[model samples]
Target: MKIRQLQFFFLAIFFVLILSGCGSSSATKEDKVIKIGATAGPYSDQVTEGIKPLLEDKGYDVEVVEYTDYVQPNLSLDQGDIDANVFQNSLYMKDFAETRGLDIIEAIKVPTAPIAIYSEKHDSIDDVEDGQSIATSNDPVNQARALAMLEDLGWIKLKEGVDPTKASEKDIAEYIKKVEIKPLEPAQLPRAMSDVDYSFVNGNFAISSGLKLNGAVYLEKTPPHYMIGVTVRESDEDAQFVKDIIEAYQSESFKKLNEEDEKYEGYVLPEWMN
Candidate 1:
């Protein structure tokens, strides 16, 4: 009886060891998997259409996760729920990560569409009238860009010596055109077009909502940092997967897609592409 009991115990130990080994191997394989998160739209399309194929060719199992809100992607990335994200510009990502105490960094800048003043009410920017309302994002980074663009168009004047990157409605020193600025969520700007005289629409939101970049009354000449970037945790900076992702964005295939695809029409090409 004792001998039989010893044999059964050793058999159980062997099975447990085998299971443990299998689990360890599965984890090792999973480390090669790359998961990317993006807002549901152009950025997600970028991963599915542009980045995924290239990385898969290199033998990485790539999964793209889509989020609707701006906050969740970074939170997911920070918590290791996703490996990378491809929605936000460098400035916005930097500010967000800093504010949330998340350690993330942009791996590469992607070709981006520029935010623009879209108007259903006017045919051109020259048709501007005083007291008309323009919709803009309430977020500081984007609102600053919109306000600065208005300033550039001679419609608004920001207070002297204010940082243009951080400018807000409160910083408006004068209303050159006396237009009311309506601050809304970035995604809501596209829908607000019919009600407002002009709405500042983010590029991703614009493209996702079936609006064309060329159809805008005015498009921004996007700054380099304002271009959307692929972000990963700072600890992953030296990882092989991160390097592969960077290579994928810089690949000729991606450039060709952007050049030929009607979906990407009027997008501001990154400096590297130019």
Candidate 2:
């Protein structure tokens, strides 16, 4: 009987030791590293130069994983390879998650960027000539905004009442001014500026590729839907760590970084900052 009691006591102590190990492992949530995803441009620059320092100040380790492809960031987020991603706007991400069946949600809005019309061939809009070739993004996710900006500038006209979000070159019911429309990949649009008369280069691409945002021939008004948004898994939306990250992102430090960077000049103000 005494032997049996001794054995049970040892077993109980072993289980207690195992539990203690786990408790220790789970202790101090701040020790966990937060992995953020972004593409190689101003977005990643924000995470590295701004968000990382802020979070690190709050005792959080941050790792900014940079990707060259837009698709990989979402894929990495959905597969739990990343804790969060912040490269896309609400509209683009919404369409991405729906089409790809990824259970991701945009939990916070980041700085927006105007879909700018740039031209190396032409000094200004006044210099534009009829039938000149123009380049814009071919990505379905961003094609509409590019087209919308062109329409807004009185270059083309979409069908009346047609949703700009879904608008494409096919929706061009009228050409306010005659110009050739070329749908090139977003990155290519910037470099192709020398080849095409004008191109709608994404803000980040324009900034990173050495194009001047302030010098754009035309900067369109950014729609609310076009602002960049931070995305996380819907399941992790309420997690305390996620909340901490969001708070850190919305901090004045982050806002200042966005504002100081020409790439983010107009779109870096956090919603709460207003």
- Which candidate has the highest lDDT of all? 1
Give Cα distance to truth, residue 109, candidate 2, Å: 0.9
In model 1, where do residues sit more than 4 Å from their true spots?
1-24
Q: In model 1, where is the ten-residue run with the lowest total lDDT?
A: 265-274
Clashes of 1: 0
Q: Write the per-residue lDDT of candidate 2 for residues 1-274, one digit (tens) a residue.
A: 9999999999999999999988878865634778999877778887888888878887887899987667899999989888999888888898988999988888888776667788877789777667998888888868988778778778888999989998988899998789998998777877898798888888777777876668888886776688888899999889877888888787877777766766566553545667
Residue runs of model 2 more than 4 Å from their true location after superposition: 1-17, 20-31, 260-270
Q: Which candidate is the best by TM-score?
A: 1
| Candidate 2 lDDT score at position 89 | 86
C-alpha TM-score for every candidate: 0.90, 0.88
Clashing pairs for model 2 are: none
